[model samples]
Target: MAAWGQRLAGVRGVLLDISGVLFDGAEGSGVPIAGSVEAVARLKRSRLKVRFCTNESQKSLGDLVELLQQLGFDISEGEVTAPAPATCLILKERGLRPYLLISDGIRSEFDQIDTSNPNCVVIADAGESFSYQNMNKAFQVLMELENPVLISLGKGRYYKETSGLMLDVGAYVKALEYACGIEAEVVGKPSPEYFKSALQEMGLEAHQAQ
Candidate 1:
């Protein structure tokens, strides 16, 4: 533990994972991990830069802020980093309409985008909405488009829910990929680009963050 601390001693900025670290989504809602709020307060007291990084694609940034606040975490919208913003940027750059397969809770995040002639299938944690009909619709969209793309917010396999381990979006993304014979573009955590962006947002180089 001492060696571990030494290794992370000079980290100017801390990028923290939201699920399983700060809180657990056991009940389908964030259940704050013991000491998490106080730990964050301590980090703030230390004047260390902190950012919450999550692969959760089921909530908008605003919604995440609210949830964190409600759970007694001192976090602002700016301090939260999730895949939605980056995904939106990619969508805009590619100029592709989205055939979204995300949760209704997060649908508003893509409200301004055009979906009239979708050529991209964006899959995320659609929860109960990941039904056969919706999957078929997304698959159909991909097949029909001249050169469609498959975008996955994150490729996490499972998450701990109140009901125990539950399948995450990766499973569904893989299924779609299998059916369509196209690989998904993952744009969330574990992606080097995503890490770089988060570090950049902290005004630090990659080496300065941990």
Candidate 2:
């Protein structure tokens, strides 16, 4: 084995970030970053397992994957570990109905989840939907719950777009937490369990992935 191969001898899986990696913040499918499309294709052909992890909550998992494919990246929905799907799993497991304050594009990911008589609040990047009316509704749900639960898809402060940095779910989550005097359970990146879930999906332990 060569020097780089030796260094990666124990590595069984690789995690690639989606946004700002394979694609830029442009509108539509977004422009592919320089050489990223080929890089991803090469990685897919490599021996190491590959997984795309993202904190993106603006679109559904399927939509995101479709966009990547449209950009000429060899990616599929199954190979991507996204926040909305993970958050849905959390919601189902907890049997918690939510007052969802999320993007319209990503709502289909939570179609199976119950929102009737919400006992908790689930928030994400609602874009223009993050109005005072919507925020207040989410806050009201949390306040009514005897035990408040706030589930954030990703605790990202902001993300870059063609227009520049835009606010993410973390900021909104903080606002609700402050008003409700409760903490949120983050379901995406920077959370140990989130990374663990990706590792688990790849059938690789923490040390086995790069």
Candidate 3:
């Protein structure tokens, strides 16, 4: 077989990571990585299909698209793929009400959904909302459900912050899994299906795209 570089020489499409690639989350809102804007512009000019894949479920799709635009990247909402849509789909299909443990800034993403009589606990980067009482409440909700399902947007262990590397939602999700004796259904990066979905959106198969 040819070398990896040779194999990727004919790549027609790209699925790019958001955090730590195009931008860094150290500043909370995110600061563009050096030369990322110009690089993305070059990619756009190349007429190659591109999609921005992010595990950040903290913001709605629209919000993320707007942020990218503000940062000087020529991107559209259609080119963005995040876990929120998948999470919403799973909740609807399973008929499970969400006991959302997400950040206040992004809570509006699920505002339209029915959260009444929650039977499922959905966890994300809750920031200050990851309180002891709230965690206990989520634990209690899981215990009450006959068949509880824990949905984790992403299993990122830690993330870069302005201060330093801080624990991410995955750490909390793991704790809950250990306590509840159940695994969380992860719906973001590192999940092969998620990557495949992004590739599908770009109209390219995994092997055809990077």
Candidate 4:
């Protein structure tokens, strides 16, 4: 415990995962975990800087923030780093027009991007939108492209929600990858760059947070 404390002494920032840690996914009626709100408040009061990082793509950033606030979390839209926004930045930077296979809630994030004549596919947690027809359509687009590009918001296999374990975007992404013989570029959790970007936003170095 002493050695662990010594190592943590250098920590200056905290990156909190929104789902599972704070609450269980359930659209607008998400249930918060016991003490998570108070824990977040304590973290905010501490010397360490805090940032909410999530792979949530089914809802807009504003909506997500509003939900958290309603659950008594003192969160702001700016302090949260979600996959949809990050994916948007990447789409703009690469100038790739994507045929989005994402939820309608967060579609506004890519409003500025051109979806006409899509050269790539951006798949996220589309919830019920991940229909057989939609998947086949995305597969067709990728197969037709000379250079198929698949951008996955996150690669989580599954996540626990209020009801039970629910399928995440990774499963669908892998299916497309297998069919198209192409790998997807993951832009959310488990991506080192994503964590780095969150830490950078908190004005801290990699060594300062774990």
lDDT value for model 2? 0.89
Measured on C-alpha atoms, candidate 4 has an lDDT of 0.92
Candidate numbers sorted by TM-score from highest down: 4, 2, 1, 3
Query: Candidate 4 regions off by >4 Å?
Result: none
Q: How many collisions per candidate? A: 2, 0, 0, 0
Estimate, for each residue in 13-97, the C-alpha lDDT of model 2 and write its tens digit. Answer: 8999989888886655588889999988888899989998999888988888888888888888889899888888888888999
* Residue pairs whose backbone atoms clash in candidate 1: 26-161, 26-162
| Superposition-based RMSD of candidate 1 using all C-alpha atoms, in angstroms | 1.5
TM-score of each predicted structure versus truth: 0.94, 0.95, 0.93, 0.97
The residue pairs that clash in candidate 4, if any, are none
Q: Which lDDT value does model 3 have at 39?
A: 92
Please report how far candidate 4 places residue 189 from its true position, in Å.
Answer: 0.9
Model 4: per-residue lDDT, tens digit, 3-28?
99999999998899998899887755
Tens-place lDDT per residue, model 3, 3-93, is 9779878798988888778877654477889999999999888867888998887777788778788888898988888898878888888
In model 4, what lDDT does residue 158 have? 90
Query: Model 3: residues >4 Å from true position, as ranges?
Result: 1-5, 26-28
Report the Cα lDDT for residue 32, model 2: 87
The TM-score measured for candidate 2 stands at 0.95
For each candidate, what is the lDDT?
0.86, 0.89, 0.86, 0.92
